[model samples]
Target: MPEDLTRTARAEGQPLSETDNVEDMYLTFALGGEDYGVGIGGVTEIVGMQRIMGVPDVPAWIKGVINLRGKVIPLVDVRLRFGMAERAYDDRTVIIVLEVAAAPVGLIVDGVSEVLDIPPAQIDRPGQFGRSRSPVMGLARVGDRVTILLDAEVLVADGDLALPAELEA
Candidate 1:
């Protein structure tokens, strides 16, 4: 399923604009038993977990980097980033590569569910929770399932780590 999404994303190879058909589409994945979604526009591809080379002097949540083809992408452990307990990576673990702020990043998730077309009407905007900024863009309600829609740019940029300038192209 991840491969299929990767192929579809690669075949398109273009970030979805507001006028595009995929504007409301989201690629949903699991993290710590909760469902999370990211706008499909920023997604480049999804790949199975592979070797991650350790890097020095970086945050623990930034779990080093991986070399896919010839591109070096920094891997972020979503669980650790969200202050959840770290779990061992299994076969279901995969990387969701995204283009945030013109830099490539890979998020390690438990597994992907599927691509869903959630219309604006079905989404509820998150209220200000006193935080300066939030990674959550909205809450998507589809039937009985509720997915936390994340702002990929904010999710990637939310910490002290300056990713764009540090990440290798």
Candidate 2:
């Protein structure tokens, strides 16, 4: 069995360890060549890239929309949302389906990384004001690399896409 890093305090109210605590799992992915993570609690699923029908008069970041099963959901290319240069989609491209505020939205990423359990102590606040202005919540240290933890709720909520009310539900 995998080691459990989900317990913070013991029965006696003492922490399990000085450096370890309950960790929230995150679904990691790549965007603009950098690794980013989103809390797994909101991730509904990860699907391979599919055809996205274009819509007019929307932000450039909004790639389009996809019909997931019987539901039509909007898709956002995270790279474009971050003002990064767009690259052609390849085999590594994927769409991370997330449920935010009762709406299902897909985030287009370069690729999907492994899920990680990162303790709160391992995440640090973004140092620069510019970083704070972005949708990222914090920077998490996972092994030897630093992963950008995104505020998925905020990212989806703050999106300027114009979708029908039925789809937003």
- Candidate 2: worst-modelled 10 consecutive residues by lDDT: 1-10
TM-score of 2: 0.80
lDDT of 1 by residue, 7-86 (tens): 12222444433453577788999998899999888899989999998877888899988889888888889999898999
Residues 1-169 of candidate 2: C-alpha lDDT, one tens digit per residue: 0233232212223334445422477778888878898887888888888999887778888899998897787898999888899999999999999888887889999988766667787899885555445687899876677899998777765566558676546
The C-alpha RMSD of each candidate to the native structure, in angstroms, is 5.8, 6.0
lDDT accuracy of residue 79 in candidate 2? 91
By summed lDDT, the worst window of 10 consecutive residues in model 1 runs over 6-15
lDDT of each: 0.81, 0.77
Give the C-alpha lDDT of model 2.
Answer: 0.77
lDDT top scorer:
1
For model 1, the superposed segments whose C-alpha errors exceed 4 Å read: 1-20, 160-169
